[model samples]
Target chain A: MRILVCVKRVPAPGAKINITADGRAVDTAHLGFTTSPHEECAVEEAVQIAEAHGGEVTVLTLGPAEAEEQLRYAASVGAHSLVLVPIEEVDWDPQRTAAALTATISGIEAAEGAFDLLLFGNESADAGGFQVGVRVAHALGRPIVNGIKGIDVGDGSVTARREIDGGFEVYEVPTPAVLGVKEGINLPRYPTMKGRLASKKAALVTIEQSTEAGGQLRERLHRPVEQVSETVILGEGPEAAAAVVDVLEELGVLA
Target chain B: MTMLVLCDHDRGTLADASLEALTFGRDLAAAAGVSCEAVVIGKGAEGAVGQLAAYGAAVVHLASHDVLTDFGPEAWGETLAQLVASCGASVVTACGTDRGNEVLAQLAARLDEPFVANCREVDPSGDTWSLTRVQWGGSLLEDATLTADHKIVSVAHHVVEAAPASEPAAGTVAAFSPDLDASLARTVVTDRVVLSRGITLSTAPVVVGGGRGVGSAEAFAPLEELAAELGGVVGCSRAVTNNGWRPHSDQVGQTGTRIAPQVYIASGISGAIQHWVGAMASKHILAINTDREANIVTRADWAVIADLHKVIPAITEEIRRRRG
Candidate 1:
């Protein structure tokens, strides 16, 4: 089995996102970057599948040269190979990104062979366009589903689980299919010291590429107006418990 | 030109998100000086047709094909694409749910047009529509332009509240059947598995959430006790989920569940922007934390400065005592 997983290097989430002076991109001077959460999980899933089924896992990314850091990190976690489609821009619209990926993937498959499974995060953490995987799958004329949390690989098909409001729906697509994986599908393993040492020597195959800017063009990026409020402090520590109960009562939930 | 709003439903009931999309599409159509029509696809969409008309749909188009019994991205995309051409729609829109964004992207790919997701604002005055969309789950915004003969977009989830029109439309329902190939059923939903039955995090009226300050997996006991006493569910921040203290299903953040409970008791959570966007939807927030400067505390309607390990149990005890 051959599994391919796509990841993006994004600024560590949970911090306040700041825009650069040019208002076209995020300010990265003081920010640390990591693999987007969902994609990280995807890497772990691919590695696990490869380990169980005795296959090879290849990690692919579309970002700047600095994205090597993320590729190396994936290597440390157990990806057998790394491929980088290096671009100069901070980001591309979904259409352009998908086009570049589709082209690059076709080249890779021609040189080697078609991967049985192609995995992508349901959406990127920063852009969250939620369309690249769909476009790529459509361009390649392959079946794809997004928001998948569970995967059961079979002889010739893969069954995926998509979480709905109350339950999960299952979809079984044939091999050589694409899937947009969501976070929480699996817990990613930490890189061992031996794995880390080996990753430092892991060579990267960089593919320089560019595409015409898609129809969606970014004009500027700005922070949303933060909502300010005056918090009423009831009390401190355990003493505040009674006040908390009173407020809950006022909200009519304590009844 | 007409703007076609794709409405979603479950079984027979229209989804609230679909109403929000209708409200957004109606307003956008009025601004662009175009007619607004709605399309509902698949089984049981007729149940939502009347509500769609009430929400300012000039005409409701019910599209049903034998293959559309279950949700399928390619099939729905094919249906919407054909409807756009048949209806002469210049713009297509839907709510920014997973399915909403997915189907529109599929449609955009089919039509070879640009599709924008989670848009907060749109300007239709120019030849290329200028749009402001949410990035980082509402922490940041991007001003953009969509250059296409056909504009496809999804309204940011919960950014605009669903509102009914003061004057209802004719509520006319028209049947639409799109030309679909048999191969489009490859990605259709095949089976369903019910994991749990009861109040989910999104539906619960009260949510007692924990964060990094909750310390360890075992320490979540007090939070669980408090939540159970309050007849609510327990939620966690991304930090807790990363630490393996709680499952991601219990996480309240951009990548997790967007909860709109009656009251969200946030304890020990620093309220990162991702987490804030999800909890911000709650009607009321009560923050309990050791640091006064934490983001959740400042934004909370009420707060308590203390250790969650002590405060959570005390709150549970106090509530029980009061009930007795």
Candidate 2:
């Protein structure tokens, strides 16, 4: 089984963010960048699938030069190879991003043999667009079972459990497919220093871009506007309860 | 006549977000001076054809194959590609919801068309789209233009309230049985279960979600109770799933689920971008986080700096007492 995990580098979602001075996009001055939260889970899923199935796991991405940091991170996570679509920057929207990714995946399929399993985070944690994996599947005209919470693959097929409305939907799909994993699909392991060191020799492949129709990448992104509301603590202990009661009573609830 | 909208359905029930997308589609179609029709897939949706027509669909194309019951992105893309080619749509529309977005993304790539997902609106210009979309977890809004022959846009969820046309036409229902090679496809649907009564997270007017800060799965009782009282669904954070407190299905985030409720009440969770992406399309966001400056507070319409342990119980009690 050769597994391909699509990974993205996004501003560390845990960091504070603001739009840049141009009001075009998120301010990166105080931000730290890392493997997108869900993509990290994808990388983990890929490596685990490889470990379990006895095959190689390759990491694929599209980004600027500094994005190589993510390839090293993928190595630490146990990826066997890295394919980076070299670009100063890539499209911001899911549509164009999907195109870039589809191009990269096609290039890989042409070089390496067809991938057995393709994994991605349910969606990029920051971009928040759950379009790529399915788009890639569509682009390649391959089967895709997505938003999988539990997966069982053996023999010649893939079985997965996904959450539906109130309960779970269990599915079975053949191999040579795509699976978009949500968090809790599996807990990702922290990269060990040894793994990181060994990852130094992993391969990174880059590709040039074709003209994209949408100029969705030009505009900057910013944080949502802050909304304000008034807050007043009631008081302490018994008095607080009394005041709270009075307030509730005044609102015609406890009266 | 000019647009084809792919309606996302499971079995027979239309995805609620699709209705919201229909609102955008109708508006976009009107702007383009073209009529819009829909292609409905999946089984068990016998009654949905009427609703699709009610939502301004001129015709409802139904393809009720057994394999179509389960969502295979490849087969779906193939189906929609054929639909577009045969139907002669200049544009294809779907909701930015997961399934619709996925199918359209694939369709666009297959057709070599440009698309933008989660676009708030699209101003159609001849053969292009001037689009606006939310970025960085609803922290930013930006505008762009797509120059493509086929302008496909995934309308943002819950951004536009759904209002069907008055005096809906009894849309002509056509049997669309496309050829699909099941052997070549990878996934098959085995079983499915739907929530019994609670409002769907994607379609709910109100959502009450608990995070790890809520402490335990046992803690969800009050939140669930309140969500019920509010006529909403109970949602969980990624931690809730990781801790084995809740199934991963209820986790809301990038890896979890994307939802657009009218009113969202988040309890005890630090608003990580992953978490925020799930429910930020809400009309109103009320965050009750212990941290006064939690990221959720910044994005919320109303922020309450209090422990959910205290607030959830008190609020539930108030609801119970008031019901009396």
Please give, for residues B1-324, the per-residue lDDT of candidate 1 as tens digits.
899998887666788899999999999999998998998889887777677888999999999898798888889999999999998899999999988999999999999899999999999987899999999887889999989999999999888889898888876888999999988888888889987788889889999999999989999998889989988999999889999999888889888888999999999899998799888889999999999999899999999999988899999999989889
**Interface RMSD values, listed in order for every candidate:** 1.3, 4.4
* Deviation from native of the Cα of residue A220 in model 1, angstroms: 1.1
lDDT of 1 by residue, A1-255 (tens): 899999999998555777799998989878899999899999999999999888988999999999999999999999988999998889988989999999988998999999999999999989889899999999999999999999989999999999887789999899889999998898899999999998888878888777878899998999988677789998888989999998999899977
RMSD of each: 1.4, 4.1
| Local error of candidate 1 at residue B33 (angstroms) | 1.4
User: lDDT at B293 for candidate 1?
Assistant: 91
Docking class of 2: acceptable
Stretches > 4 Å off in candidate 2: A14-16, A22-25, A90-112, A128-130, A139-141, A201-255, B43-46, B64-70, B166-170, B182-185, B193-208, B211-247, B258-265, B281-305, B314-324
lDDT of 2 at A83: 81
Per-prediction DockQ comes to 0.80, 0.42
